[model samples]
Target: MTRFAPFLLLALVACGDNDPRYLISAPAETGTAGQVALRVATLEVRQVSLPAYAAEDEILREDETGALKPVQGALWADTPPRAMTQLLADRIAARSRAQVAAEPWPLSTPAQALVDVRVSELAARLDGQMHLTGQFAISSPDQIVRERIAPFAIAVPLAGDTPAEIARATGRALEQLAEQVIATLRR
Candidate 1:
């Protein structure tokens, strides 16, 4: 059991990736109809937040008031936001039946629906918890169409938890979120 202990015990037990599959969700009342759901071919991961600040394996010991506690987690990912954006794109593609390309949308008059995902937060707690988030915006050059927050969080349990396990949980949350966003945008 010890050999497989890491795999057996996982926080937010999931299938793939360390980042949560999440979709910054718009309120149920909102919908982007008349919008042709095009492919989210690429995601340029801009540094909204510094990576060195949230290194993998560095336990995130937050100060009181829910601030990001100083410290690090047990493990880390080379590029958390990048990994998550890709994972989310994949999920959104699968769920919304939208074609996902590796390249960005072709610059033209306007895209049917343009999706931009921004990581609002991605980190692990010193106490052992994982969080992944993204904000989605459907917009055009002239107008801002819609927006929402895709945040996922789960505890890193002492038992049945490993770095890999949490990673998968993270991925799952992102995937689900992306799928949801795609659905709304496509609708």
Candidate 2:
């Protein structure tokens, strides 16, 4: 009975850990205030590939020694890769006239360009700065354009030392990432 009592108590304590889930996404560029003109007709954004640590659902912070520490009581609403992919699709679609679709292109007609992103760093640092670094490649169906991979890095300053601030900084980094992708596609 003593052993059973300990197990029950542990289970009850575990059930009480309900942490809030945070979502990582870039804001839509829906407004025409600062939108760049449409450059591509159709674009397919493939599933974003991320490193093992960054792919986790938890909000991770990097220390000076390069150790990853999960933010207590905070998690991502969805896997980082999926969230990032959808966010990129939305941002690209809004900024351009291209019909953006995620993996397994849903349209009857094929996409004109395919965008692939590989994220290496996507986390907030102990110093209150969020950084995003990755390489992306754009490929066209036709042989008219040659495919090339470009590296991009963006850092956003946090407004305060809070989880919400970290999330906002992450959003800003994502926004910059989307802009870089769009610019690269145009070039």
Candidates in order have lDDT scores of 0.46, 0.80
The collision pairs in model 2 are none
Instruction: Estimate the lDDT of model 2.
Output: 0.80
For model 1, the local distance difference test gives 0.46
Q: Ten residues in a row with the worst lDDT in model 1?
A: 21-30
Q: What is the lDDT of residue 143 in candidate 1?
A: 38
Question: Candidate 2 at residue 90, lDDT?
Answer: 82
173 Cα displacement, candidate 2 (Å): 0.8
Question: What lDDT is reached at residue 38 by model 2?
Answer: 41
Candidate 1 wrong stretches, greater than 4 Å: 1-52, 55-78, 102-111, 126-129, 142-161
Model 2 per-residue lDDT tens digits across residues 1-187: 8979989999999898488888775555556565555446778899999989888877878767989888787888878788888888888877765688887799898887888999888778877789889899988877445677999988898787566677778878877888888887664
lDDT of 1 by residue, 33-70 (tens): 43345343322222233245543334344455667653
